[model samples]
Target: MVRIREDDINEIRNKAGIVDIISRYLPVYRKGKSYTALCPFHDDHTPSLSISEDKQIYKCFVCGAGGNVFSFVQNYEKITFPEAVVKVASLIDYPLDYEADDVREKIDPHKETLYRILEDTIKYSMYELNNTEAKKQYLEGRGLDERVRQRFEIGYNPPNDALYRFLKAKGYTD
Candidate 1:
């Protein structure tokens, strides 16, 4: 994923209304020029969290927890700062793009072959669970029914260790 730019973060913050964003997490009541709600960060009998409509900032008088909408989400939701920024950015429909690189290297062809072998192992294991006599008892013993095995794509490796020889025959070197 692309990192959000500072300008884009600021623009998203400005576009997203503090009241709308805060209301999603907690209930807010309009009190004259600002909105009030119970402080989420600390225990309190009375509503001490105040949101400034003009400044686009919120403050809790009881806990002294205060910041912009992004900070509030980060604190209340226990999410990362960047996550908060991305959440707010998505709310306001901010455009972000990742830098792409196209480069190829010729090395370790066996790595790709190993990956293919592992994939084939998984596929064969699943087939064994359904069709083979030895695998049927093993699957039942493990409580791995058809549904469970299908869900996880569980399979077994060949007993003869044929995978290595198969890859070698297919022009793969370790």
Candidate 2:
């Protein structure tokens, strides 16, 4: 599950036009301000795919399949969402720097369990910090604001067996 930044996704969408991308796959004819092409999604069509260059979207009136540039590539190429994003970016020659600021080291196969446990622990701590007002106040008092906490990946460990219970429920052993 590679998490791409929303900003990068928007930028790519803005840069890549719906008409340009769809035209690469099929022959589209100008119909007023919009374009029309035979809907590849279904059989025997007379230009049912209505592509709006202004809206940057496409709709197959027969099949009811419609979406943006990324979705068009995704469906057309039969690729995953992330792969479609990369494909769209490549098509427009847009450089995609989607990796997070935190440079995580690659985990060894042997240490996979440990890595999962660490990730679970982080999630549990984050939940605790969010739910516990006292914990939030303590962090705020110590000058750890929301932005600072988010930047540092700060979290709180509640004074209870919550973590133990959470790990147990997740099937992580001691």
Candidate 3:
């Protein structure tokens, strides 16, 4: 996953017009002060998607689909948020690539090892949680479903030396 700076995203949002981008996907027409288009998100006989150029936003009254340009592109194109940002930047001819400072160069070298250790521990804990029925039951009792667990990488580390053994196996020094 590539990281896009917030400034670049905001710049694309500011430069691109909501109506223009939406119009590229579907027909947009002048309706009073705002623009109107048939909701592409849902089956519709009339124009229900209201696009406000003043506010730089769009909203579908019937299905409640709404957002700014990046979100609109994301939802409509079924692409990731970063992909949508890249697409929008391309649409308006905004340069997306910029040299970013190397963060690793400034951080303590030991920090990377610590991060790896923590990451490995998390992975081992997640494996334990999946294999342990009691842990799964406890998560369910707390209303944490599989979806939430997977989303948050929720895991458990048993009160044992398993984690230490796992780390040692991965060649981590004490």
Residues 1-174, candidate 3, lDDT per residue (tens digit)? 547899998889999999999999999999999999999899988999999999999999999999999889999999979889988989989999843344325767699899999888888888999999998998999999999998998889889898998899999999
The worst-scoring run of ten residues by lDDT in candidate 3 lies at 98-107
lDDT of 1 at 157: 56
TM-score of each: 0.54, 0.55, 0.56
Stretches of model 2 off by over 4 angstroms after superposition: 99-174
- Candidate 1: give the clashing pairs: 125-155, 125-156, 126-155
**Model 2 lDDT per residue over 1-174, tens place:** 546878888899999988988889999899998999998888835999999998888998889999999999999899878778888888999989765335567768769988888889998888889888988998899999999988877888878898999999999777
Ranking by TM-score: 3, 2, 1
Model 1, span 35-82: residue lDDT tens: 999999999678999999999999998789999999999998898777
CA shift of 85, model 1, Å: 0.4
- C-alpha RMSD of each candidate structure in angstroms: 7.4, 14.1, 11.6
Q: Local distance difference test, per candidate?
A: 0.80, 0.87, 0.90
Per the 3 Å backbone cut-off, how many clashing residue pairs does candidate 2 have?
Answer: 0
Query: How many pairs of residues collide in each model?
Result: 3, 0, 0
> Which structure is stronger by lDDT: 2 or 3?
3
Best by lDDT: 3
